[model samples]
Target chain A: MKVTWSRRHVLETDDWSREEIEHVLDTANGMLEVLSRPIRRAPPLRGRTVILFFAEASTRTRVSFELAAKALSADVVNITATGSSVEKGESLLDTARTLEALGGDVLVIRHGSSGAPYFVAQRVGAAVINAGDGAHAHPTQGLLDAYTLRAKLGDLAGKRIVVVGDVLHSRVARSDINALVPLGARVTLSGPPTLLPAAWRCGDLPSGVGYEPDVDRALDGADGVIALRLQRERQEAGLLPSIREYARTWGLTEPRVATMRPGAPVMHPGPMNEGVEIDAAVAHGARSLIEEQVTNGVAVRMALLYLLIAGGEPRLIVGAEPPTSIAGGEPPATPLPTGVV
Target chain B: MTTFDRRALEAAGYLVVPGFIDLHVHLREPGFEDSETIASGARAALRGGFTTVCAMPNTEPAIDSPGLIAELVARAKAANAARVLPVATITRGRKGKELADLVELAAAGAVAFSDDGSPVDDARLFRSALEYARAADRPVLEHPQDLALSARGVMHEGRVSADLGLPGIPAAAEEAAIARDLALAKLSGARLHLQHVSTARSVELVRRAKADGLAVTCEVTPHHLALTDAWVAGDRTVAWEGRPSPRATPFDASTKVNPPLRTEGDVRALWDALADGTIDAIATDHAPHASVKKDVEYDLAAFGISGLETALPLLLGGVDAGWAALDTVIAALTTGPARVLGIDVPDDDWTVVDRAATWIVTAAGLASKGKNTPLLGRELRGRVVMSVVGGDVRYEGDLRAAPLAVR
Candidate 1:
């Protein structure tokens, strides 16, 4: 069931085949070993150029992907069109194409549009990596998640992963779900209704994507918890409600961590308002995989870059796994009917 | 038969009705036993007073071929309890792929056709299924889900799911599939039977489709017609029994079935559909998963519970709960399902002494295998004292088991 990683859509995890998921996971693991070597690491993207264009403001993602590219010896260029052409009114597609025309070898992008990466991937000849996109997906986040889970659980096939926080708003959790699913893990996404995405999209979530809303409920037998940092900017932009109430209801505390299945790791796509999205104590706890996730980001991205350069011929060498099928994973979920987003 | 006195039956308010029928039941004969076996399941069906049950085709090996349909017919007749009408898979192996041998399956006693637990995603494939069903003069029952819309949702997507934090199975998921099926059915001139519709909007869709002159009929599961995702609120912990339910509460793993349970508004709509003639029949979707498979973590629990034993009492209990009329309720259990399955069981073929037979029963007394009954300890308004299918008294709880006179 291992499939080729066609740079089409990063909308959901199943967008890639189980083979692709495994390839990414194994490559990430290999990168982990490569990072741990006395040599530290070899530059995989020695001559490549990685362009980071984030429409939405970010500190962790921009840094992680940027650092990832830098660690791979790639030339990195960062762009935040927030105050640029976007303020003056420029479409996202045009912006992506503009980046493509500028000799961008790899477009590591995060946008407000769900399928922005896929659009750019199709339009440009360069390899496209989704940094994060409009409440839709963050492919590298998912890759790092798979890396973190593999580090803790060793294998993902039978592991139970619970992703908690603003699912409707966090591009991190959405993409994490997309990655975890194809990696042969039982992934559940939970959050308040305001943050919950279309349930139907998760129903037939192509690769074992399970949906839960209650964080406590989703956390019961969970082997890992990926707490999404509810974007504070989302509240300012009115994508979410009050932050204090959100923290009170969704904040992962040490006590809550104690209640999780033993040794269950916790993760956050960082630059977290520590006590707001997750308790500072739990964020620093033994089970906290946030730091490890950052470390794996460079590795996961190295694998993605390696895969892009190697193309179809050497993908099989990365150890692709079998795909897990579910009655769910049905997609094209009933869209809100209005393309208003 | 353990004979019981008529006095005891009458005291329970049980009465005699014409044979009862269920349009949806998965016997799991050709394949899949981690879930159910035909014999044990059929025994439960007989105990539930179902003289007939239409078994679905989404089994392990799948029942898309005429040979599988023929095998099902032989097995059911051999059991000689409930008449098992086979619903062959509309597509090969129910992948929603290519069309199957509809004519062959129909000729070999497939009363209907369906992918059952899945919607035929391909429009051309679905249209072909309808065309084949129309040509064979059979209904293609479908578990409609607009894959895209129904994704991510682990339960009925709405206020309760949001409040409980369970991924909601949006009303549009059901609507999208049903709408597409209706359109295809209309275009292909096919008789389309929708299975396990769980939303009020679905009722509206079916109602509108029927009004538009589309030959569409729909069935509602008892779970959907009764419970909602709110059941998880009583113990939000149930949502995480590790499984996600897009339709009903992840209550008892054994109770998990798809086109999952809906909200109270959905329940009202189902009842309203029955009352207004929008819902065509009452089907059990009598899925029986082993205790181990269903008792696992909610996410791991098999997505089905056995309902053959409770269909009648549950319908009658709906009356007790002020959800249906006496005649309408029995009609749903008996004539409604029979008609939906394309069977014509007449009153003259059997005997109906009383329609208001009371069934005061405990879950322990019901012969269903899986202990996933959401209706345990509830009283029902009517009971089938005798189920005489085709002139054979297949069931007689407290009444006489007489030979059915129907030819």
Candidate 2:
């Protein structure tokens, strides 16, 4: 189906319509086929440049974006704040402009400040993909999680999806709620009062979402679960009494999983604290989709690079004149193999 | 009156009133000249229809000594744009630990004492400062905030901050500090003036203090009177009383300010306070910062709005919408602030305003170097055509040209 995608940047899922989100999921299906192939190379973004500007430390998201760009044959450069000009007090806009001046076509930015990518996207012309700005939106993570859930549960409408732990500080939980509520999934956030503020219960939750401080009650009759990592800094800030108490009360455990509907899947955005937020047994268990989420992360990101750089209309890249310039002679045109059009 | 004077007065939408006096302004001079100098800030004051402005002492080298006060006064005289009054810091270096020499500062032409950027958090030290300031006969202007409650918050705590996932400064932060200061004022029998009072509960506290006959006064900023915390959402329609406009930019750092903008209910409470005489004056709190400070992430950006150039049109818009009486608004700007400083509004100083004149606010059009206003692109309804001070035409012409009488 030819859907008109007018958005040039992916900053947050708050403003995205259900159709736009479904379009990205549909495009990721084709990228999954491409990833499954032995060669795994694509020519859609052959001559484009993708810059990974990670001002914060990350292993999963950074690798996922780099591999996704490489698979599409785009040039990728990585910049971290440790030894770069950012450490010397250079501003985020200056760094983005330097990348833009060097011919970067798409800038993937991750910063410790919330709204850092939105700050850069307003100033630069390059397409910006937010790689988890501070406690703000992580649109691609939300997309991949949605993709994984749809693959397992068939349809998300009217499904009870419980998101557990440190929700006030987790960009993942925010994006998940933003992504799920529109697709008709009833999301309930559960955590301690310090981590899940009472404001979320008093008319602050988005339509079709609820707040439950008790994890057991939230998990009752849930179709799936997404457990967020509880950083130790919350304890340092006097939010939690101790990690052990948090685990004993709010953490997802074997008994907690048994309270859910039978065969309900469990997911976690990774680098989890094994005994803290989720037990190791539940993470590596049969119904866990944590590994599938990492794989789907690459696919979802590849689809984003393709749609944003290729202007959402696949015919423009497949058969019509290519939008971005090709360095070598024009590669032979090939129709997208997975019925993406 | 002369025939020419009468003719000009009879002209459509033109009104001549006493020149405005701003009790709070951060002429970021002795330090941070890249953002604004004393001379440039004075020029901005003249262009904004203010004949007299009290300079805040939060600059670098902290205006704590008589020599710094004399130097600031000298710089303002050299600029010769608007009358600038020096406000000395209550603490020796505005460190909130030790009190500065209030007797010497008051003797050196300091009209007020304040720790404008940081509140005097120490109760014992604050009590001593208030007692000393009373003897010196200068009102202790406080920037009311409990840092512990407002820790690391970038905007107001409410439904908006919850959705944006940013740290929030709850209304309790300001209310708690106000309650403390009012009790201190009652204990010491000293004059207390709060700067940039932002919350509804803060107004109620001040109103109660006034009814109890405590010497308490407070001022509200134009931004807080008109704009709400929703401005951080980048939607102008929700931010103020304006037409539904498209989002200029999302997560704009320009909307970031200290004691961040509160909800619409709070804004309404402020208007009610102003109408009923709970709010003593309308001070600009005209803090300016270089673009380098405001062009970063909203969290990393400095907390202020370059508000000197926009204060008049913003309030006049409120008056036009029947939110406040014109006489009350003008008095809050002119005679009201004059009474706060215990100074006389000079008879010769006047501002000529064209209420029907409309202009769009742009960065390049501003006299102040800081262009960090959330109203950057909106059309404002009034303009100051001329400003007069001490029988001299200090500023005349459209805002495009420099003032005519720079010393």
Candidate 3:
């Protein structure tokens, strides 16, 4: 299959094609090569400006995107919600437009509201990347996790991966399914009955995914695992009894890790709730890919910025098409009109 | 009443029905004026062929006192289009605790009592309100919802909402609340009107309650009858599939509403209820919110569609599609709603609709201040060409001059 890139927004992963997923993986491999060299820098985006418009607090997503942009030799500016015009009664659209007016060529937004980046992308000419929206998509994170799993396990096809924790509130869980399911991997979500409720399982579990309340049952023979952050507020909201109870029932302990295929690799989109969702020893264990996921995060984002920004030219890449589209076996997408970029 | 020549009216493709009486509408006056004023909402209602519209009481100060009801009555009369009858809040500030003076409010020209936007959750308080309403000779309309159950849900709890990744507001939230309200109404023998029945279970509940001889009635919105949550989850291309266009989230925010649009099964049940006379009336629930309020994310955006200008024609479209007989739908919009609020259906007031005519709904063309309709750009049939209230022509549409003297 030969495909060209011209799209300008990175929102949810629900519509990604297998070919597109592989395309990002292939591109991230190249980015990893660039990161390996001493004094690493890429000049494809040297003259462009990347703006980080974060309306929510973050440590990993913010720093990784900043480093990725800087490594591409692009000028980067960071804006936060508090102590800014956003606090002085400026609307999300107005703030987005103001950033575009300030010569931002790429906008990376992490808003507290879902679909905020999609809203901005429709109005502005700049490239929009959703850093993380409220329980919505986090596309870049989805891509990096897939890349990490593929790198470690060789292929994601036919693999069983259990995503355990507050799948309801985790945007990471949404993104992971979007990325993993299309690649022929079976994903099961496991957590307390409150966090992994019946609604998530019944309506739209995307064909390749299922949910299990028993963490032990879900992790049985699983090839990989992604543990999500469990906010202490869940207990206060009566979704759980207490953090200690959660860790005992649902937390990924070393014993639980042993139940999976040997060296199955555990991953977390980190700032881990160490005792709550995963144990410290398990996080630092031999099968843990937590640190590698952080490293791959930069590579994956670099690949995304390249494809969305630098790969807008009328060049085609020859590759074998993935078996399915992002919507799980939907037909290959209709290409955008010529010279859209 | 002025009678038109039958041949001339038939040549013009016009069908005259008694002017519509809407049982529920949020005029947003005395608060949130930027979204809509009483004058603006009434004019919009008149344009849609409505003669009388019951204004909901969920406002800034709320319509709890006789003085507040009197002020609204005066404001509606001064507006001078559709008659705006006040629906006073059942509780002071709609706090769901203390009951309001229902007797005095009815005397002060409040036709009904309701906390239409917020539910009166307490069973004890709701029972007290219903008992008082019986004495006042007014119906008590309740926006039924188990708040704790529907806590953070943004849309209908179903497959569409699940696919869209929004928190689901289960149908049980409405079913549980209505069950409680019906039990109280049965116990108290009060006139109870269920506001915006959205699910199949709700329609069945209302039907059973009426059969059991309880004084209960319910209204369904045009959007709910015409659309389902599938429309709310429109086609989308995921980000990884390539570049995700802004067009991805097109229907997400606009289709959001209270008692959110349910399933196709529910839509079928509503049509069946309307046809079988189980549902009482068709109300716009014509809630108008400013663009700034609705253009945000689904959870953050207000729950409403500015519906006054589009309701009649949309229901008429349902008629044309064989969803219901024309007369039955007309009754739901006119005499049926008038009876719900005990308003007299005057023979002198009527609107002439061009059943064969078609027009696209647009924000710039509507009389209401709110432009948040989901029906924007839809080419719909059955336009109200001219409306007459109290023998006065309130709205004359483009086809008025081409009339073979429609009214």
Candidate 4:
């Protein structure tokens, strides 16, 4: 099915449809094939500039997005909030405007504030990508998680995926539910009652989403599971007791994985709190898609940058003179060669 | 007081009524003067057909002592547009600890006492303030909120906050504080006026407290009665004047008001309370902040909306929308607030409002220094054609041609 790419900002997955999710997964699969090629680069976004403006410290998302932009032959400029004019009290909009003025084509922003990218997108004509926002959304991470699941277990229709831990502060949990639910996956969130209140389960969240306090009950017969990082501050804030207690109670151990359907992939949007949120034994085990999720993260981000920047409407990306126009290539689009990276 | 040109007023064919008395207005002076001052706020109030407005005591230093109260009164007198009665802080610097000298403040012309902007959370301290305020014959207006329950919450906790992914400040945060303060008000037999009441249960609690013969009177803001969280649910974009941009999405900060705009059901309940006389007044709660303070990200932005210019027109539009009867709306603005403040409202002082006149809201049109209202650019019915305060023509919307000729 032919779908028009209209959205200029990839802020959240809430507005994503089933077809959009499938299209992203398919595009990521194509990009995965491109990753295996000898040259491992595409000319679609050849001269475009993609800025990585991260206010928060991130390893996987930053590097993955950087690699994706580089692989597409776009110039990547990385900026951090610390030791910059941002620290000198420059407002978020001012910084964004400055970057746009400096010829930023597509801005992939990871801000500590929720809706920061949306704020920037409204001000500038450049394409905005929300790499991660505070407890709000991480669309690429969600898409990659979904892609890894789809690649592993085939079609995800009617599958149950259990997302465990710190749902209140987990942007991944929000993005995951937004991405997976519409694709016929019944997602159950499991966490300490304080961390995942009943209030988060309501509102615009999908009807297929449910919550269970018992980790075991949530993981029972789960087709997949995504473990969230538990910040130590939760204990200090009295949201939980101790890390040891959390590990014992909610952590994904090998024993807990055994209760799930055989080879039900375990996932974590990384920099994992190994002992606290997930046991290292299960994380590195054959059934865990931890490494595959990371590998697919690059592919998914490549797909996003490609589709959004390269394949996006030309009117959205301001100021950059493209060397090659991806818009010219449409209608029975050329597929990337299917090879393993 | 300057005398009104009665002959000119007659020539204009304007209807006159008592000057509006706003019980809750944040002049933001003595500190955040960049947003509002005594002169700017009084001018804004006058433009809205208000002659008297009770200024909240949540300034930088707070109107805690008789000295500060005297200073505010003096400043308002110099401003000369409206009567800006100072409301003293309940506690020292509004820290919610150590009661201020309420009797001295009252003697110095403080109309009421409130720890607005920050709630007087401590039950004992608040109760003490109530007891002391009873002696002064001034009501203790509480900005009812349990900070513990509303920790880091940016908007009303419900379906909308859930949808927006912003932390929810549950209705219980206001309801719980209201319930406790009402109980304390009853215990002390002190006059208590709840400021900016925003939830359904809050109205219900206030209604019951009043029924139980408690000296409880509450005021709802015009924004609270007209708008819901849906306005802020998404980007909260408004086409505010100035600044080059066509759209201003306060994102989180734009609509980041305290006791955040509640649900539609709560809006309906506020009108119900107003209709049944359960709610006493419609206060503007015209809190203003500089664009630098408000135009930032949601979590970092200050709480408030500059409502002085838009309050009467919006409520009058509300009447057109069938939100309330015109008489009821008029009573809430004038007599209702006058009763809450326990002041003998002068029957002679009034502003002529053209019920048929329509005007679109604009930042340039507002007399207030702060251009931070949500109603900008929206065409609203009802315009204050001429405002007379203390027999002086303070605001004349059409007095453009003749600078000194009152007509």
Candidate 5:
């Protein structure tokens, strides 16, 4: 199907509609086939430049975006705060302009400030993707998580998904709710009151989301479970008493997993504390989709890079046979070499 | 004045009122000239209809000594725009450690004593400062905020901050500090003035203190009365009323200010307080920050708005909206602030405002060097046509010109 994608930035999923989200997921499915192949490459974004500007440290997200850009044959340059001009206090706008001037078609930014990506997006002409911006949003992760869930359990409509732990600080959880609620999913957030603020239930969160302090009640008959990483800083900040206490009370153990539907997938946006937020068994268990979430992250990012940079056009090799199930399972009728793509 | 000019002024329904007195303004001179100088801030004040302004002493090295106060007086005299009343720091260097020579500073022309950017966190030191300020015969202006509660928060702690995932400054930060200051004021019997009272409970606290016969006064900012924290959510429409349309993106650092714009409920309470005389004055905090300071991330951006030029129009808009009685709003700007500072403002020093005029607030149009205001593109009602300070025409915009071009 020919998709006329007009959006230049994927800063947040808050304003994305159900159709827009499904379109991204559909595009991601095609990218997954490319990832599954031996060649594992596409020519859609060939000669294009993708700048991974991570002001905050992130191994998973940064690498995932790098792999996504490389898979689409785009030149990827990684810029981190520690070594770059950011260390000399170059403003986000200046850094973005510098990269854009060097022919960066897309700027994937991860910043410690909540609205840093939005700050850059407003100033630059490049397609901006929010890799994660301080407690504010991780839209691509939200999309990938949704992609993983939808791949496992078809049609998320009215599906019960419980997101447990650190919802207050989790841009992942906020974006998940932003992405899920529009796709007809009931998102219940469960954690300690310090991490999962009461305001989430009444504040401007999407309508289909709720807060459940009781982890068991929150997990009860849930279709899927997403466990968030519990940062040690939260304890130092007096938000949590102790790591041991957090594990004893709110940790996702085998018993808690059993409360949900049998075989319901457990997921975490990782660098996980195995014994704290989730047990080692559940993390490595048959029900865990954490690893798949990471893999799907690449595909979701590729879909975004393609849709935003390539403008939703499938630009495969000139004379090669169209890979089955690529580009939403329908090959372009005419394989035109559009230089713009 | 010529008969034609008077008739034109009359035809335009201009109201000549007492020159506005801003009790709280940051003339970021002495140190941060990149943001504002006494000359520019005074000119901006004159453009806004303020003939006299209390220049807050949160400058580099702060106006803590008699020498600095005299220097500020000299600079204001040279500026020749608005009367700049220098407020001396309560603590030497505003360190909140040792007290400044309040008597000497006051005698040098310090109208009030304050460390306006920060609260005097130590209760003992604050109480001592109040006692000393009483001897100096100047009100101790408190920038009410408990740094502990307001730790690292960029905006008001409410539904908006919660939704945005930004840290919030709870209303308790202001109230807790106010409670401590009120207790100290009662103990010292010194006149205490609260700066930029934003929360509803703060208004109530000052109201009860005034009823209990404590010498307490507070000033509210126009941004607080007219705008809410919703402005931070990137909806200009949210400054007035209603929920932001779905298209509202987050983060405009221009809306970032210390004692962040609060909820709509707080705005309503402030309006009610302003009308009921619970709120003593409407002082433009008039904090000016360099564009570089505000052109970055929301968390990193400096907390201020270049408010000197926008104050009159914003308060006038409030009057037009029937938020407060016209007389109440005018008094809050003029006589109320005069009473707060205990100054006999000259009757001849007045401002001619075209009440029917409307002008859009633009950065280039502002006389102040700081162009960081949330009201940047907004068309505000009422414009100051001319301002006379000490019977001298300090600022004279074309009175008969079209409103849009007058500024």
Candidate 6:
């Protein structure tokens, strides 16, 4: 009668709660302080050995985690999960056990199945952090996105944000769903009908997420914008006529970004398709946090590393609110939950 | 010279068998009139040649208290042609969480205690019931089912149901309960009587338990012994609607019973249990329901068919027709069940089974309150000429007038 769930086991946003979202965001603020310092790093994962297991091709995240580990002075092992003994029928469970046997402390996995990380983490007794999996989740990218927005807008509650582009195939969309919903911002998933799983209900997601098919409808109540990457690997064979046809219907140009709630930030999850996805003018535009997100990525990874390893001491807390301890153990803050003082 | 000693004449082609016993039957009372009543049903039982019957605890008010048991016993005494022994519920209700007043119920002449239609789910409560039964020196007739496993399920889960688009009720639901109950019995030292043991494997468990000296016994319904899932299908809309289905459909309001029917192999296995003494007895499970209530779809059908008048004839007819031997047949109906209930049956009962005497049974001519007679219009082989309850004639049949003897 009892079952447990962990990691990016689900394919959409509403998986993370608002309180949990805020906790991660609070942790992110601690990360920002680590950035402003001259040392740029500290021992977060001191005695821990972290293994970055990525079977998918990677770019920013792969480097960010390794550098994050190096900055924290933890031993690190990077292994591609494909074409190993696993292809010879080694279960995800057996491989995880083998890795744990080798003294691997944490498994940071990115794979092609939506719940692969969850499966691996559950099979062996290990703490798992999802990197990216099958158009499902990129938790680190989601943290960087929130860390960027929180830096500018102060607190995210009542903030307006719109995510654009081929969100239908972005693992970052799944992560953003978890991040944005609880950060106190409203989210609408806008994409073609074919991209939607029929069973998906906006309420069924974690706290603050929703789905919509119309871009104009999304822009109507928008705050900030997050444009996701198009994974050509996700396209059904011959389902789409051509790249031009996809661009005409679903692409996000600068003009589209201009229609958001005024002063709302624009963001992307990197490896952008240039003029085809979002016009070049907007990619390098002044209103964009695209570069700040990567810088925030290393900072967030450092923050995550510090909290996960050395456990950061609370510093001169800034515009950020206190950690919302909704962890069943804490007493309700106001005799009941209300906005943080 | 002898105008013919009908009772003694009845003793020849067959043995002067004592009245057969049925440990389960539902004489739906307190309100449901269209279905059945103790009066007409007992008359049917008399005609069926059962000298004694054990009434189920599931009724209008439910037989959970001494007052309800007394009420049913009163109605049964006034109505019965046979001795009626009603099993009282083991809880203030058959809710199964709390133990009922076992000592009080046993004092009120309850043949046994059971929560039959519903299984007691909570393990601690069931163990408590078993302990209570042990202390009271009575038996707990368990309705074998783990509700969670058998949720919203209808037919036995197998190939037939898959093809018919029927929901599967896995054998595990029943077997799981049986296994747990036997273990509980082992711990409590109480006797356990398994109700409607349909599968061969279930009989094997009881046999093993008996060999190991655990006080365990089981009963199989006539329907489970005789019907199968093939009855669920039909040729060109019921050309193969099955021999039991048509007659059952009329009174079928009461035709639906739980542990719904198993497969053909299970039926054969039940017969095998009868032959090998694996099954201790045959119970009509004579669940009666009104005709109006049966008009619903098979999925929602009430579970009974009139068996008061059919139990003896069916088993005896089945024997005469080569479906079973009379020795195996009589043992299931008489001493096999009597011993399960701890009754000391005398030796000279079967001398009254007159095989030559004919039975004129037809649904058109029955007096049962249930209109859903599954055997209507089918001519079965044997009939009870009369019942001798306590050395007295409780029932007698009219002689068939011959052309010359008509004068």
What DockQ results do all the predictions give, each relative to the true complex?
0.03, 0.62, 0.36, 0.34, 0.57, 0.01
**Model 1 misplaced regions, further than 4 Å:** A1-194, A197-341, B1-14, B235-251, B346-364, B376-382, B398-407
Residue lDDT tens for model 4, B1-407: 33566666555555467788999998988998998999999999988888889998888888888888888889999988888889998888888879999899999999899988888888988888899999999998889898999999888876556655678798899999998999999899999999999988999999898889999999999888877786674533221212232334435465778989888789889988999998889998898888888777777778889888888877775676676787898899889988888888865677776665667878888888888867677677677767777777777786433322221
Model 3 segments beyond 4 Å from truth?
A312-341, B1-7, B235-252, B400-407
| Candidate 5 per-residue lDDT over residues A84-188, each given as its tens digit | 999998888788678767767899999999999998887788889999998888999899999999999889998999999898788999899888888999998
Best by DockQ: 2
If ranked by DockQ, best first, what sequence of candidates would result? 2, 5, 3, 4, 1, 6
Q: Residue A121 CA error for candidate 4 (Å)?
A: 1.4
| Candidate closer to the true structure by DockQ (higher is better), 3 or 6 | 3
Q: List the candidates' TM-scores in order.
A: 0.54, 0.94, 0.92, 0.90, 0.94, 0.51
Cα RMSD (angstroms) for every candidate in the order listed: 20.1, 4.3, 5.8, 5.8, 3.9, 25.7
Model 5 pairs in collision: none
Which candidate, 1 or 5, would have the higher TM-score against the true structure? 5
Worst 10 residues of 2 chain A by lDDT: A332-341
Ranking by lDDT: 2, 5, 3, 4, 1, 6
Decoy 3 TM-score against native: 0.92
TM-score winner between 4 and 6, please give it: 4
* lDDT for each residue of candidate 3 in A308-339, tens digit (9 for 90 to 100): 76653212111233211221122224476543
lDDT of 1 at B305: 54
DockQ for candidate 6? 0.01
- All candidates: interface RMSD: 15.3, 1.4, 2.4, 2.7, 2.0, 20.2
Which stretches in model 6 have alpha-carbon errors above 4 Å?
A1-341, B1-7, B11-15, B235-255, B317-323, B346-362, B401-407
- Taken over the whole model, the C-alpha lDDT of each candidate is 0.68, 0.87, 0.82, 0.81, 0.86, 0.66
DockQ of 3: 0.36
- Tell me the tens digit of each residue's lDDT in model 1 across A192-310: 66566544234634346677766677778788888877767767855467888777777788877777789999988777788887998999989998888888888887777655554
The worst-scoring run of ten residues by lDDT in candidate 1 chain A lies at: A322-331
